[model samples]
Target: MIRLRAHHLLCLLTYVGRGYTPAFVAQYSAIVARLNAGEGAVLVEGPDDICAPMLDSGHHCREPRITTRDALAREAVAAALGQSLAPGDTIPLDGPTIARLRENFAAGTIRAACAACQWDGLCSGIAASGFSRTRLSGAPV
Candidate 1:
């Protein structure tokens, strides 16, 4: 269990070796639990990895290019995560819903990626309000 950003989980398959910290395990376990609990996970295919063997594995792959919209969404999520907001925070403890957003960011699937999400509307609304990187440093997303 690694305390990694959602992007790491999207791109990395293996959870490396021993002496894992409790926090790391908790964080990652939460993600796995969410995935196993039937929450939808969006795993966009990396741009250059279109021909990569990992995608060919046919396990958890989708072919979609990342885009500016996705980049904004990912940035927002990162901002929120940086705040380490609890379940009751203004941002709902929406579970591991961010996996796909991270994937979309990596794969260049900006526009069509978030069609299935409740937060899709929010993302657009926020970006429209001039969601800036500086605000990410000042407060949580």
Candidate 2:
């Protein structure tokens, strides 16, 4: 199973093979490929698979602001999925679920955690474009 922080669940929706560094993007792309291939994901508290590459570089995965973003993402995602999402909880990445999240994201209902994120504009543009050209696949059209 892929281990991911709460905020990453939102990030995956608009991922288009870009990240902080080449290694980070490589790792994230691999993770997205796994998810697209039907892999499952478990919610984690801090640095997860995606953060592995950046961990050795003194990344800010443990910062208070980042943690706060995770908390907000957890709450928003939990509400969106109508399920309690805590650390160690399994998240379903099915097409329907992804579509639902994308819909909410586009409508701005599940974007509270994105307010302070650097990729907010990019993600917003992706959502506005109906998630076209995103790396993720297998969702119903």
- Highest TM-score against the true fold, candidate: 2
> lDDT by residue for model 1 over 1-141, one digit each (tens)?
112223333222222211134544454445545434543333331322221333335523343333433444445454544644221223322334344333343344543435554444545544444432211111112
> In order, what lDDT does every prediction score?
0.35, 0.90
Model 2 residue runs over 4 Å out of place are: 138-141
* Tens digit of per-residue lDDT, candidate 2, span 13-122: 99998899999999999999888888888999988899999988888898888899899999999999898999999888878899889988899888998987889999
- Give the Cα-based TM-score of candidate 2 against the true structure: 0.95
lDDT: worst 10-residue window of model 2 = 132-141
lDDT of 1 at 39: 39
Instruction: For candidate 2, list the clashing residue pairs, or say none.
Output: none
Q: Model 1 shows how many backbone clashes?
A: 8
